[model samples]
Target chain A: MSLARVHNFAISLDGFGTGFGQSKELHFGHAGDRLHQWMFGTQSWQRTSGSRGVDNVFVRDTDVKIGAEIMGAGKWGHPGWEDDPDWKGAWGPNPPFHTPVFVLTRHQREPIEMEGGTTFHFLDTTPAEALETARKAADGKDVRIGGGATVIRAFLAAGLIDHMHLVVVPILLGRGVRLWGEDIEGIEKDYVIESTPSPSGVTHVTFTRKA
Target chain B: MSLARVHNFAISLDGFGTGFGQSKELHFGHAGDRLHQWMFGTQSWQRTSGSRGVDNVFVRDTDVKIGAEIMGAGKWGHPGWEDDPDWKGAWGPNPPFHTPVFVLTRHQREPIEMEGGTTFHFLDTTPAEALETARKAADGKDVRIGGGATVIRAFLAAGLIDHMHLVVVPILLGRGVRLWGEDIEGIEKDYVIESTPSPSGVTHVTFTRKA
Candidate 1:
């Protein structure tokens, strides 16, 4: 069985998943984008876009080492913009996520073709369908659940998630849309302290899921 | 002249103000709604809507305790349904913020009108303008910098805030957005802590701005 893990997901030191008010131009707002600076500075993010550069060792090794990528409807595709005649991918033609991707959405849309092997398919069914699709697509690789909290909670509640790696940045988006909320209940997690360092004053932590 | 405290805004445990997304229907998402549950259960939020059922001691002391309210354009208005126009305010006919509200936005929109003396003025001019407007409206009362993080940061960076209250919730968004980022540098804050316990397994902490 393929294991489900959310890797390189950054949380605030106060435990916020996303910042607030996601839009077409700026998804996840300013605070959300800040969480990505660590990864964005990495060669992984640049290499996927056909750029050449290298970040620090930390960014290269830990920030961008996901085996497979999974995301919810919000992160996968834009609603109204999907049909935009000029609607190219949100990222420049070459996006950071180069591997196979699974999108969790309620609507069915045609698979999108982009540079590299990236193919975006909309999953209109339940989490089970998304998981199955991701499992087959992952080819025995660890499936990384990319998210906006609701989707992550769905996987956690289903007990489908195996490990969680959360990078806690030191900022607090005092107010905005928020990452997780009252929706999560029954899921209990014992976080195994993987790493803790204050480089750039942000602490990165990883947890292993109990088998 | 009143002192501007930067860290006095209240934050939810999970780190959301009104919640995520653009759809007003989902505005303040459940966690956002739940964040205010305490205020709702109290006289502060309920009495504004003219519901006087008597609540706890905190409510008894702070009837309309909040001095002023601040927020972002994202939370002020949303795209209404096809038949209904988008010009509609976020809270429909009446919004909870009965006091003057400073809305952080780059777009130039006219001030909004609603019942209970709430007027949503778009602050494209500057953070100082918003603060000045809110202060004038506040009439020597404390100002509540309601936020989406960016707005809050603007106030914090400008040294325009006086106090902060953060309510740490237990859920994590995995990835949505963040609050503090690189732009914030060389600011000092001194606060007095006030802790309150709740049934939701969340702790509400109030920080008084100390000069």
Candidate 2:
């Protein structure tokens, strides 16, 4: 439906997606890597990242549905390096998500080349603008909000998202950056719960938006 | 030996500790159940919750560790009831935490007993006051900052914690609640990476208070 759906925006249970005052060294901070356990074992990610394996139906279905992805600059890790053109896409080698990605940033930079069909488009655009661009590029597929928290919250606070898939891994990053801030106010969310447990004990839940 | 340990608090990667509006029904929210996957499989939780004959290390450790606990009125999802002599602890049949818990609420209530050693104490004390009471009641043990977000944040901001174990679940709950607010400023955290994976693919990271 061309709606902006913030799919799989991983944040810390501590209300942070990334730690505060983020630098390149602290992308997602401390135990931030723990959040991606679900993706690593998934066929969608494995195939894209170049691995040969039998696929789990649930993981496969969930992975291929994503069409476009967006993230804030912090999620992207760096924004002021446009002049140097030294920025690299967060994923190394062949990245997952063989789709277009829109990165929200302040400084304008050239598009980043990535493996697979993924391309990192740095946009100084507002949330609405990025959503619109992502929607157009998504080609009827869902627009995934890959985030560092503030970016996703912006879209969510504006009520622009349609669905969210939250995978709750069981690790805690006590401190670093927090994605959710109390400064945000005036919002309501209604979700239908769809939960499934992988053999590894990672619970994958899909929250379809209601109103 | 009291130090402000990083990772003492945990949050759902979706940025909510529970559902909105602080309603009792909203205690865990739709996906809130997934947040406690670690403790659910813990031996301590299993034994206390009456899930015996289940051989699992994670479950056993988490259960016995929280031998006693506490909460605030706001976290209990009920107020005024705390003033009653019959105020009971949350969880039915057997509560989630099998230990004795002292809750810090403005309302004073009699200690309501449960099937297990778990009891609810509604205290009108402040953060320090509650900690003093909790420490004594903890049987010279670790006092868990069983949270409703605000309560945990209060203790954290007050520098009253020793060690924090944070499990970063792998999902983003785009909207609902936040852990820290803009009003919470100038706080610092340091963490060491103690990352291990649970059977459920949930990473268990332990953070000690850095001197």
Candidate 3:
């Protein structure tokens, strides 16, 4: 069975996955790259060499086999990429995700295959349906939930997420998209939660589904 | 100069200081002590003997000299506490606070002296003015900001808090009063935020005003 998983997701202290006023130039809006500094500091992101700190431990995903990914329209492009036919994705040719990436959006388009086995497939569907399609595309490996906040909240509220690893950044975004709320109250009952704080001042929290 | 400090405050993963549907019986409402389990497990609250681990390190507050406290009405009594004239406080005879406590409410009742040095003073004033009154009563000692979420946010938004120690529990209350949001956007620029994860899964986050 292919498990639905979310990895290396970062959010603000106030629960904002990204900051307000996002634009083409600002993928995370006012948030800038503040939320992902931990990942960037990791040896994995540094490639040749970097710190092997606790943050690197949670961020390292080279051992896992991810077959496919499901992301939302907000993450696929700038504000209005649908208007331009030439817009492929924010990720240039040879994107990082080398899998069949399912992009959830009302404006469905034909599949566009990028270099490095990454293909963008537009779909207008619910969380459950999207996960099903992504699972099939994932083959026998786990399906990664690539998010920008709204998409992750939807899947979490729907109880479709089997495992989740969220990094809580120290800053307070004040305004932006929230990752959790009253819609998913008591969500803790479904998962065994654990948190590990790194010396880097960020706390990495993981949620594993109950057996 | 006396500092305004917040200590041992517990909030949910989603930033809810307390739960929803609060009543006389449920101060934290749907949260039902879940957000405070970390504190209860500490040696301070446990009284006899408990884990002196990282959680206990943050929960211990006996060393500080607290002259006065300012808390919201919700922390003083239940939802309809105003209707009852005989209602003293939730903390029976000897309240844990051995100092004057200023309760923020519109009722504007007279001061009620309790057993110990604790005395409840009802004030219908702004956060700054209330802090002034509490400051005088504090007699040069630190003024602790006792909260139920709204009170804390008010002080925080007003830029009056000097130091805040918040414990982020692993659970998600889903529905309740939020501690941070758009109202306080960019507030992080004012203070230095640091987080440390405990062995018990709770993350202790502290914010210290810049020098």
Candidate 4:
């Protein structure tokens, strides 16, 4: 059985996944890269210069055994991405996700086959429907929930996530898209939560569903 | 010079200091004792039966050299506390705070002297003005900010907090009054933030002002 996993999802001290006023140019808006600065210093991000710490260990797990990816429209491109037919996503030619990536959006578009093995498949579906589509595309492998906050929160609210790895960054982004909503109370009852604070000043929190 | 400090301030993973709809019966509202279950097992709480761990270390620091305290009216009493003129604080006769504790409220009342050196002084003043009264009453000792979120947010917005110790419990109180607000975006630039996660599933976060 394949799992619906979320890895290396960074949030501010205030639980904001992305800052306010996120635009085409500024992906994280006023937050900049502050939420993910800790990962940049890891060996998985540097590839050649960074140190092999707990952060690097978690960063490397981003690509481990994950087949297809499901992300919200905001994460695939900017706000007005649907208007532009030539939107190639935030990642360049060869995206990090080498699997068949499913983009959940209201405005549907044909599958765009990018360089490398990555292909962007647009779908207008609910969290459960999208997961079913992504799971089939995954081909017996796990499906990674590539988030922009809303998508992850939806999946979480629907009780579809099996494993979630959230990194709590030490800074507070006062205004942003918050991950935890009013419907998320008692969500911990379904999962075994564990938190480990690394020396780099970020705490890695994991919620693994009890079988 | 005496500094303004905050200690043993517990918050949920979502940054809620206290849950929504707090009443006289339900002090923390929907959150119940989940936000503070980590402290209940510590030596500082159980007196004779608790363990001496990192939680106890920070818990014991709550009353270290704190001559006076400033807390919000919500922390002192329930929502409609002003109506009851004869109501003492939640913490019986001999309260935990053995100092001049100033309660920030819209309605002013005469000071109530409790047992164990805890005197509740009601004041209707701004964070700066209230701090002035507390500092004078502190008499060369540090003033601790006892909070229920609003008062702490006010002092934080005013840049009057010299030291802040926030404990992030693993639980997520989905709906409640949040500690971080829009005015606190670049507040991290003023202090050195440190995060230490204990085995008891709580992360102790400290913000020390740069000298």
In terms of lDDT, the poorest run of 10 residues in model 1 chain B is B4-13
Q: For model 4, how does the per-residue alpha-carbon lDDT over B1-211 read when each residue is reduced to its tens digit?
A: 8889999889988889999889999998988888888999998899988979899999998888888999998999998988998888999999989899999988899999999899999999899998889989999999999997888988999999999999888787888888888887778889988888788888899999999
lDDT tens string, model 1, A97-123? 777777776556677777876777667
- TM-score against truth, every candidate: 0.48, 0.53, 0.96, 0.98
Model 2, range B1-211, lDDT digits (tens) per residue?
2232323234554455554544455565554565666556554555656334322443344444443555656666554453555435456767766666777765666676777566777688778878777777766666677676777667766767566565545444445545655434333344333445444535554555556
lDDT of each: 0.58, 0.59, 0.88, 0.90
Q: Please tell me the TM-score of chain B in candidate 1 relative to the true structure's chain B.
A: 0.71
Off by over 4 Å in 1: A30-32, A40-67, A83-88, A186-195, B1-211
* Candidate 3 segments exceeding 4 Å error: none
Model 2 misplaced regions, further than 4 Å: A20-22, A42-67, A77-80, A92-97, A110-116, A183-188, B1-211
Residue A30 alpha-carbon offset, candidate 4, angstroms: 0.8
Worst 10 residues of 3 chain B by lDDT: B54-63
For TM-score, candidate 2 versus 4, the one ahead is: 4
Proportion of native contacts kept per candidate:
0.11, 0.05, 0.92, 0.69
Would candidate 4 be rated incorrect, acceptable, medium or high by CAPRI criteria?
medium
- Model 2 chain B poorest ten-residue lDDT run: B1-10
DockQ of each: 0.07, 0.10, 0.79, 0.76
Which digits, one per residue and each the tens of the lDDT, describe model 3 over residues B4-56?
Answer: 99998899889988888899999899989888777787887788988898888
Docking class of 2: incorrect
Stronger candidate by lDDT (3 vs 4): 4
**C-alpha RMSD values across all candidates:** 13.3, 8.8, 1.5, 1.0
